[model samples]
Each structure stands twice: as structure tokens, then as C-alpha cells.
Target: MTTTHEISADCKACGSCVEICPNRILQKDAAGKVFFRPDRLWMCFRCGQCMSICPSRAVMIPGLSYETDFYPQPALDERAFDAFETLAANRRAGRSFQDRPVPRELLEKLVEVIALAPPSFPPVKTELTVVADPALMHRSLGLMIDLYDNLVKKMANPVARFFIRRQAGRETFITLNNHVIPLLKERLPDLKSGKEDTLTRRAPAMILFHSDRQSENYRTDIAIAMTYAILAAPALGLAGTIIDLIPPAVEKSPALRALFQIPAGSEVVGAVILGFPKRRFLRGIRRPLKSVTWL
Candidate 1:
């Protein structure tokens, strides 16, 4: 499937589509009717702005339907900003979860939000896998713990450390050495002894966001989708947290590959565990970025 747009005779000559096109491929003729430039056709990334803003529904993009894709947008209340601020301010990393599994309906709602996430490109290249079964999640958690334990052990060897650093790059090796290794070393005994779970936090459900390794901007695409899911969770009566360890572990483990049905040459870019939160915070914490500069 490739991108193509068609303008119908019903075009109202409003000039809205021409102005809205990102690539400026849509133009106005001397008659003020909107037409696509043939030479500039290659620049059209199919963002659908023209079709979306057309009042007469005259603009059509392949794989999209005016009737189905466009809906009556509801007006936001004056308090909408307050509501959004409250939602954003209250979001916290949910590390502990209740024993029960997250409802399928709620998970589907998160998926819907994920669907709305803007792709880095016109067609979304990312994929999501929901592990909703409690037993399956538990098994996956065990595998991840095992994988990290092995990683800690492997990083302890000079030869292994040297090879890993060379292969994974300096920044990646620094992250593993300074952050991941210490955290795993401290948690591995407890993790194996069933004392506590610092990994998935025993959440009853998890979603893996992944894509083909060769896909352009797949990492950012998956990150955006995962962010949408986590942000949408509290509204659906669920808690969510992004787990950084899962993706790397998934990439390395043949067992995890089979479990998640991750195809060859694809990468798991992000993962998040979701469930009813084990506890609630009385107050939200303030976390500002280290630096901000205005140009």
C-alpha cells in the first residue's frame, strides 16, 4: 500500500486543503480550485491534513474513508486544560500491582489510544503485543529475571565486558555498567529467591511495542505509542509503568522470542506493565528536567 490523494469535483474552493498540506503539494489554480502538483507529488507524505480539513469531504486518500475516518469533534470545556494538567501531574510510575489481571476492555482502550498516536511516518511501522494472561505474565517475568541474572554474571567477566562494550557501543556499555549492572546485581538474589520483583513488578498484564529492526524511526514510533498507552491508562482505571529491561531481554532470549512470537529481524523497542495499582500516592512529586534553554 502506497500514498495517493484524489480531489473530487465537490471541492468547495475554500483553499483550506491547499494551506493545510505540509509539503505544499496541494495548490490553487487561477480558478481558486485546489489541485495537486504533479512535480511535487513525490513530496506528499500522506499526512491526511487535506482530507481531514476538507469541509465538503472532497479530498480522498487511499486506505482512508471520509465517513469512517472523520468524526464530529466535540468542543472542549473551559476546564479541559485543568483536567489535562491534573491527569499529567498525577501520573507516576506504578511499580506494584494488585493480584488480579487488568480487564481486557481496559487494555483495549489503551490500544485505542495507542492507535491515535502520531506515527513518525505516514504508515505506522510499530507493533504491539499484549500479554494479558496472568500465568503467561508470571512466566515471562521469571524469564526476564533469569535473563538479567545471566547478564550480571556475564558483565562480571573482563573478556565478556570488553566484547560487550565493543559490540554494543560506548554509550550502551556505560548504561549497562553504571545503571543496569548495579541494579540487577542488587536485585538478582531477591528476584531469584522470590523476595521481590523489581522488574515487571508482578503486574498481571504487559504490552510489548516493537517493530522491524530496519524500519525507519521505529524506536521513536514505539516510544510515542507506549507513552500514549501509559498516559491513557489512569483514565481507564488502570496503572501503568514503562519497563526498560524487557526489550533488551526480549531481544536476547530465544525463549522470550517464542513466547512473544517476535519474528526474526524485528526488535522490541518498549514494554509496559499494566494492572490495578497496589497503592495510591497522597501527593504528586515535582520532577523538573536538569536543564532547559530557550533559543
Candidate 2:
């Protein structure tokens, strides 16, 4: 008796398995597609090399192995591109947040979407800290503001002062020993309605993305995850703004680091304050793209 197997037509003919087969048992058919000859099956150690290298994801080894099914493909669609363009056109600093709370279930869903983001390697190694308490959110914002005030008073350069003052409201410095109050104040007006403070608008949830300091892909991995959250927020009828005020505060205060339970070797690369957007953009704008080539 003999057994025969079928090669999936969906195979992209990448030849990845052919290159890696130790026994050279896999061969390309006349159409340059990979196929396993009956004689070569005996030589197969069942190393699963063919299953691993098939880029089309059409390979299956039946009882040999199983892979966890991934959901909600993380790749962005055309609508996402349009949203990105809208963000670029407005060029408005997301200064204020709303007081609306994000439901825990929705937050979990957002995390699920983030989980789909492409990691640096096969096994993703990123961690998330979600803070939903209003008191803590305010405390974190206050800490950043206080640090910003102290740094500004210490700065002596006039140009630096002007630059800081000019962009004051738009930037959020989450690093240690940097003053972020002026920037917060400058952007506050855009976010404020009447006497109400719109910036730090008191969202129901905040998510902090952290990475191991020694991990080669720490920064890149965290960044991609954060981007996933940003894109998915709008779809969920939620809005988020990345805060840069935490890393600096964490760097300066051991107590703060302990409060957030940040490990000694890890750093907070980014933070996103999440909630429903109080203001929405209804139109798109345009700007000139600039480029220079030295050839």
C-alpha cells in the first residue's frame, strides 16, 4: 500500500520549504511549485519544515501540529488610510479628552485588537498596563505638570524659552525632569469650552505600553501595538491621545515607578489616554508633501 498527498494550489511558490529541507526531499514541479515525491516521504523526518515555510498559510499537517487561530487581521484597510490622512490634515494637537468612561469589556476588545498587531518575532513579548481610575489619571497628569514647571524655571536660554513657549500647549513631555505645564496650557484653550478644562478631559481608561529595556525590539514592538490601539479606537467610537509625561516622571521618581509597578529593567515607551472624543472632524484638509534627493 502507498499514500499520496496533495499540494495546495494556493501556495505562492515561495520555495521556502525547498530551501530548508535537510534531506532535499521536497522538489519543485514543472510550474515551480513545491511537491513531495513518494520516494522522498521516507526520508522526511516529519520536521514540519514544509508546514513552517509555506507563506500562503495553506499548509496543514493534520495530527502533527496545531496553530492558534488569529482573529480580526491587524492589517489596516483603505478607511484607515483616510483616517490617517485626516489626522495629518488637522495637525491639531489632541490636547483634551472627554469624561466618558470606556467599558471594561470594550477595553478588553481593544486589547484583543492590539494583540493582533505584528510583533517583532513569532512569540509576542509586550505588556500593557491599563489604569481606569480617575484619581490616578489626574495624579499622573499633575505629576507631569509639576515636573514641567520645575524644568521651565530652571531653563536659562532665551531661544529655548521662546521655542518652549511657542509650542507650549501642544507637547506632552513624559520624561523625567521635563516641564510639561506650559505645553499643556497652550493646548488647553483648543480643548477648553467656556471655563471647563478639555485637555486631560478625564477619560475612563488609560493604557500604558512598556517594553523590556534589554529587548532589541522593545521600542519598535510597543510602538506598533500603540498604533493598533490608536486605529482601533475610532472604530469603537472611542478616542485616544498618547501621553509622553510618564516616562520622565518614572525616570525621576522611584516611588512613581513602584506605584506603576514598572520593573527595574523595563521602560514606559508610550501611554494612551482613552475615551470617547468630545470633538470630531467632519472634513478633510490637504498640505504639500516636501522632499529632497541628493543624487
Candidate 3:
């Protein structure tokens, strides 16, 4: 059927599409024209090479036919590319945020830009929990602290620790008990009485990403979208940091999960806290890649 391919009479058989075919699924007939063989129709991937390269715009794909669906983005020149590198290098894990909350309009615009970012083919979607309100985030952080406190008490007991180790594996439980729990406990007073103000590090906003249980590539999808989200933030004069500390606790405790507003039947896979940074970084130190094995 014509479901997967369509070429209007506007096609000039210029071979632009033919040259760009990644799968080589399209082949020439005796007329020196391009057509996908019937057997190879099953292999057709909607990568949109044909549509993108077609000079006449004769080629069409579902959901990509509209004029607004495609646009010409010029390649970054040397100066633009250098600016990109600089922004990337200077990207900081901003734990300390200014007391001012991110403007709702700015957050809305950021989300709008991220919505246009690509996901994998048949991409799994993620649900975002945006804690934009300073008051709301404060309340939620308090609740999260309470839930984590209860978990620490349970994990501290020798009998409880043994069962947890058995269930969550020894190294995992040990890390929770030895490292994560103690740190939270030390900060518990500051968290509880609101004295220290470093509980969630004074972030004015937090964005939590969660995936539905049914998606097979939940983590991958969440991570890819998260990369887009964090990258987009710095461009708007905002900053973001990937959050690993919260998800582990949220995954383990139902109350914590609920406190973070993780939807039922979905799990928090990735998260980030975002806000205006207190101070900008002038230069960034490099962390070189260690293991390189080129075949």
C-alpha cells in the first residue's frame, strides 16, 4: 500500500532522495527512476531522508507533511559552534539557587522548546512533575524529608538492615545505610526545623521525570528527554542539575513517591532541579575521558 511511501508528480527523479537513502531500500527501475521494491517495504523506516532532500517537496510522510513540520536550520559556523562548546563546558550542577523563583512564563517557554526535541522512533514519553511554586516545593521538600527520615530509622536496625540487604542486594543497601542515610540524618535537623535551608539546597523549582511501567525503553527515553531539558535551561539564563539522590528514595518508599507526586503505576527514572544560579562560572575544568579503546 501507499501508507509508507508517497511521491507526487512534482518529483523530478533528481536522485537527491536516492543519494540520501540510508537503508538503500529505494532502487532504480529501467526508467532510471527510484522506487522501493515490494519485498523491502517492510524495511522502510520513516527517517524522512526522502522528504528532507527532495527539492520539489513531492515526498510526503505522515505527520511531517505540513509546512510547519519542517524548517531549515543552518549548520553552526565556527563562532556559533565555539559558543555552544563554551556553554556546554560552563554548564554547572547548580545546587545553590537564588531565593527568587523562576518566572512561570519562562518555565512555560522552556517546556515549549523541549517539547520540540526528538525522542526515539516509537519513542516512549515521560511525565514531568514541575514544582514551580516556591511554597509548594518547600512543603514537598518537608514531606520528602519526613519520608526519608522514617526510611532511615527502618534501615538503621540490624534486623531491618539484613532484610533490606537481602531484598535490595548487599552493596546497594550498604550504600544507602552507610552513605546516603547518615548524610540525610546529619541534615535532618536543618531539614525538619528549616534552620539549615540546605535540605533541597534552596532550589526554587524541581522537575521530576517519571516513566510509565509499560514502556520497555523507559530509562533511555527519560534520559534523552532530560538531556534536552537541561541543555535548554542554560540557554534561557537558567541552570539545572541532574538529580540522582531523590529518585532512589522515591523508588523505595510509597510515601516518598507520593510526596514527590510520582503518578501511580509510573516510576521516577530521572530528575533535575532548576533555578537561576547565584553566581555564574567564568571557566570550567575538564574531566577527560579515561578509557579509550578504538578498534
Candidate 4:
């Protein structure tokens, strides 16, 4: 456990550290020196809010487990809000993509911005890895398809289906029979022709977000971070969609995890496939909410 964070000699005693501490662990003594209750160290969120809000760069938090070198900028004005709203309205889930690859620098910039995804709990950090190589992307998708194909094959056996249905429940059969198999069969001709990988959308790039799954808020953190990344994509001249299929497959198979080079104890919670869209949308569509409440 990192026990001590520093307050430098340059401290202006502005009390920002005391005010912004999420855990309320920092305090100012009668001498106006910032100090902390050592017993409350366990509650520190390590959010670096104190260091950020300080007018003097004196509160040096070396004891925190995360990054603190970042500086905030003013990005939320009316014009910025309107621009974001337009971006949100125009956002599309780009199923089909152009053949061109995303530039490395641009993709890196998107990853940097999306790294701002918030941690819902103490220390669950979401990591983003971009699979920008077309060859590697196709091979990885092929490996996932192989897993599904093997599953589809095994489920074809009466004995295997009997055991699987008993062990995994009826939804496995329902998903395979109704959804998975039909879609695969429908794309058979396309698969044979090598015209496309209908499943992956064969996007020029893929982003995989991996995180520890022990916490109850794990999935929520993943969702929030992924949502932020998705909303931020259109502005970066890219398009993406939330991929629900691959994560389940990865969760079920260690081989799939190894194929993507995910960390040993971590799991893939969010996957986004990004690329330039092949076609442009003429207008934004609407989806009205069903219900609301006021008290």
C-alpha cells in the first residue's frame, strides 16, 4: 500500500486539497499545513482532484497508484455543447466500412482521448488496445469465427447438444439455432466469395477494452467508458459500434483471450470496431423514450 502523498514547500495553503479530496481524507492543521489521517488512507480514491484543482503545483501525490501529469482544459461551452450534440445526433454504428486503414497517429489520438474513461470504483482501469493491422484483424476475427464454428459443430451432435443444453441452458441452443446459425448460413456465399467478413464488419481497425471483473461495478465502468469512446469517434473522423458478440466468446474461451493477447487475469468487457464508413447517412433518425417520471 502506498501510504504517503507529498505536499511541497511551495504549498499556498489554499485548502483545495482538503476541499477536493473525494474521501475527505486530507485536512489542514492549526498551523495551516495540509495533513491526512493515516487511518483513512484505505479510502483514498487516488482521483488526483486535489493536485488538479490546486493553483500552486505543490500537492505532489506520489503515493497515488494512477497518473497525475494531466492538465484540464475548458471544453464545455455553448458552442462546444452544440457541436457535441450534432456529433451525437450524427453518430452511426458503421456496419460497413471503407477499405482504407485508419492513420496510426489519428487512431492513437482517439485512444488518448478515450483513456479519460472514469473509474467507477477504487482501481478498475480500462485499457484500450487498437488492432490496426488488417492482416491481424482478419486473423483474430477468423479465430473467433473458428470458436463459434466449433461450437456450432459440437452442438450438431445429439449427445453434445444434450450435455450442452443441460449444462449451459436452453438459450445456447436457441441462440445457435435461431440467430447464430441463420446469420452464418445467410453469409455463406459471401464468406465463400471472400467479399467480406459479415460478422466483424471487417473494419480497418478494432479497439478492445479489458479490465478486472471482480468488482460489481466492472460492467458499468466498461459501458460508460465504451459509450464515451463511441460518442467521441465521429469527431475523430471514424465510426464504430458496440460489439456484444466477441466479449461473450472471449469470456468463455481462454484460447480466444490468448489470441487477442489479453492479460491473464483480466477479461474483455468492451470491443469497438472502427473504420471509415462506406456510405454516409443523409439525416439523423429518432428513437423516442417510452416513459419518464417526475416527483
- The residue ranges of model 1 lying beyond 4 angstroms of the native Cα positions read 1-4, 292-295
lDDT tens digits by residue: candidate 4, 1-295: 1356777788888898899898888889889898876778678777778777877777766555334455565667669878978989978898988998989987888877776777776465786667888877777776677777776677678998788778767877687778876777677457546676776788888888887655557777888878877888888888988887777677778776776788877878888989988898998889888977778
Candidate 1 lDDT, 176-211, residue by residue in tens = 999999988888899999899888888999999989
Best by lDDT: 1
RMSD of 1: 1.8
RMSD of each: 1.8, 9.3, 3.0, 3.2
Per-candidate TM-scores read 0.95, 0.60, 0.84, 0.85
Better of 1 and 2 by lDDT: 1
Alpha carbon lDDT of residue 68, candidate 2? 50
Highest TM-score among the candidates is held by which one? 1
lDDT tens readout by residue for model 2, 45-149: 555556766777654543344255422336787798788765445433344556656788888998998987877653566888887777776666555555544
Q: How well is each residue in 1-295 modelled by candidate 3, as lDDT tens digits?
A: 2355766778788878777877776777799777766677566557777777888987766556638656775677779877877668767888878899999887887777656655554433777887788887777677677777877797868888778789988787778878888888898877888787555677888788887887777788778777877877888788988877767667777766766678788888877888999888877887889987899
Better of 1 and 3 by TM-score: 1
TM-score rank order: 1, 4, 3, 2
Give the alpha-carbon lDDT of every model: 0.87, 0.66, 0.76, 0.77
In model 3, what lDDT does residue 289 have? Answer: 90
Winner of 2 and 3 under lDDT = 3
Between candidates 3 and 4, name the one with more favorable lDDT: 4
